[model samples]
Target: MNWQELGKQVADYAPLLGGVLGGPSGAAFGTILASKFGTKETPNDIAAAIQADPNAALKLKEVESNNETKLQELYLKDKQNARLSHKDSRMPAALSIALTLFVVLVVYLLFFAPVPDASKDVLFMLLGVVVKEWSNAMQYWYGTTRSSSDKTKLIAARN
Candidate 1:
């Protein structure tokens, strides 16, 4: 079965694992699922197990909850790696700045400019995408509350 199909099925039970299954690291996450579920390391096997067992969803949730700490560590590590990799590169910051400027321009145009009826729909769609991406860019640059909390926990533990 395709990753998307498996992800959809698993998402109903384990949202986090489902997301991982649907992402770029689906195969790796599938291996984890397989080990936990005692299935073959394949989406098809995992999907079948989830479908066959009535308690599979509960089990999946339990598994995710139990491994939440490890998952958070992995997530934080990935973000740290990304930040380190981009430390010397200006592209990420430049992109964020550009996106900020574009969002401002789009909002200004929408509020003040006389947009043509035919182009308004396209512009609105573009605006939606740009705004969403701008939020993501800001989050990447500033870090999210979850990340901040994790940092606090780390510091507390270190002390």
Candidate 2:
């Protein structure tokens, strides 16, 4: 099974770790889960272990709590790297502009252009792609809800 599927199964027990398992760094987090559970380094095995053990959820929570600091560090480092890359290259900016233009074009086509019934489906599919890409670009440029939530948590902890 995929990491996402495994993540769903694990979510009931450890929401934070399940989210990590479902993200871009799922494999890395999966390895951590495997090691913690004494299972093989695979989503399937880890999921099975989680199912077999009655205390899996509690153990997973402990693992998540123990690794929380590392997770935060990883998130900070990733954001730092993105910022550094943006400073060194114009590709991200260029791509963001291109994506924005494409989205605008798609919106115009959907609303104003005479789209054929047959072509409408294709256009809609392209629109979905554009929307997902636009969201990624927005996240890269403005940060995501996760970052905002993290910031809030940090502020709360400081108080």
Candidate 3:
């Protein structure tokens, strides 16, 4: 199957898996597919491999679990570090402000202030950025793993 077909198969079957696999699991699945197999691997290919070797799916799940553990550890450390400093940190304060404005603008335009279509369009465009950034900030579990260069940078930052 082609990439598009593989994506379609994932979309169709993923929801049935439920939980993380069902919701917003595309990135995780894609990472597993691309890294374990290859970018060109398809759903049919995965299914065949799993049938031939039952360990195939298990290996992918292991990768996902390891990534989740690492992200959880890192996130918890950030939380603990903040607590030890005795300072509350709103790391996304500016994003919060922008999202607030987006909500207010949406509510205002929808109910009270019937804005022009062009202005509404602009508001929606800005709202999209907020949504995208919010997702990306939480994407470590399903996002691509750090490359060697990025790993070096991460180690350097620790020192």
Candidate 4:
């Protein structure tokens, strides 16, 4: 049997394993299960065993419960860390102050300042661009960016 073929089988099973577990991290369940239970057998052997054992799915589902609990715990810990870090950082406070000042300036320019209509229009357009750019930057930083290594793995798996 081809080594890669066996790997492909496991890869194919990963999503199913994930589905049984039911979570964002379910895709990782296959790797964890393989590590825990896979010893000498190839993926084919494991599949055959699972087919033969009537209680295999049940057992795997039981493991999924444990995995889901651990995943949830990790998520909570990460969220708590994020909150604490946000509180400790000065950037958020600085940004808030700067945005408040900008709002005040915009209100003044629009309502109280004897600015020309043309200048006000220009300022509004410029502010719109700035806001869009800032939103894009924030999304880029906070979004889930796929790394080159992940792409490489995907391409290699395909082959």
Candidate 5:
């Protein structure tokens, strides 16, 4: 019934909950909230851990409901905050010009990279592929760390 045990329980059920929610967000939020605010034990486990008082049960239910509401609110707030803070092209015209120039430069490089060779195009394409793969790997790493850290913090909070 301690936070550590409760956290393990949450982690155990997270995959199932993630499937139900169709995303990792739901499972991560549920696990964190349950561990942070809800009783140390799951709803079913609560009754036996503490005295089965009607008032306590009612309070527990209230807390669970509020936790869910708060979780949704937090999620929405975070989304809104991210949307608001996300890059709003300060100079769209300039950005477009820069992008066009970059594309032209790439084309120029592919056609003529100091050395007249078909391998230039192949090397450019390989470089682009490598950059794309690296970007994807970084994004995946960030998302995973964020979710894992969130769960870790909630678990640590219990101790």
Candidate 6:
């Protein structure tokens, strides 16, 4: 729905829903019954009288249905937003992880594998990339795995 229409709907329905959720109590019901009955009556007395009145029950049912519809609409909007965000981010995230792993492998071959000083600049650059990625990945998953739960207990005991 467009923003303007959605805003209008919220403006119109919020008060009605608030009244229904609050039930036919307090000032609203007092005003309604006082005007109709032309006497002072407590909210509970008004409610008991309304229970015997078929017309009031029908009006209440209509309000309850409209409130349920509005709640369903809001829930579907949230679900759609979550789906769109996850779909947009998945591919780029996988590509970043793959690139980091490739750089790490290349660095290992150049620095630790049987290779000479002629490629030292390339080796250092690759090594730097590997170390950066390793540190970042470690930080990202820190305390995220099953083993970390045990580590946490140990640290807690020490403290």
C-alpha lDDT of all candidate models, in order: 0.79, 0.82, 0.51, 0.54, 0.48, 0.51
Per-residue lDDT tens digits for candidate 1, residues 52-120, read 888898888887787777655554665666666665687878999999999999999999999989989
| Tens-digit lDDT track of model 2 for 65-102 | 89887766655665666565655577878999999999
Q: For residues 1-159, what per-residue lDDT tens digits would candidate 4 score against the true structure?
A: 433443344334443343333433433544555555553344455555555666666656565556666755644665556655664466754664565567567767778879887798888886776566555444433544324435655998999
TM-score of each: 0.51, 0.47, 0.27, 0.34, 0.30, 0.27
Better lDDT candidate (1, 2): 2
Please give the range of 10 consecutive residues that has the lowest summed lDDT in model 2: 79-88
Instruction: Score candidate 1 by lDDT.
Output: 0.79
What does each candidate score in C-alpha RMSD?
6.3, 8.1, 12.7, 15.5, 15.2, 18.3
Poorest lDDT segment (10 consecutive residues) of candidate 1: 70-79
Worst 10 residues of 4 by lDDT: 15-24
Residue 142, candidate 5: Cα error in Å is 29
User: What is the Cα-based TM-score of model 5?
Assistant: 0.30
Error of 2 at 52 (Å): 0.3
Give the TM-score (vs. native) of candidate 4: 0.34
Model 5, 37-119: lDDT tens digits are 44543433542433444354444445445566654555566565654463354554454455555556666766666745767
Q: Residue 26 in candidate 1 has what lDDT?
A: 68
What order do candidates take by lDDT, descending?
A: 2, 1, 4, 3, 6, 5
Candidate number that wins on TM-score, 2 or 3: 2
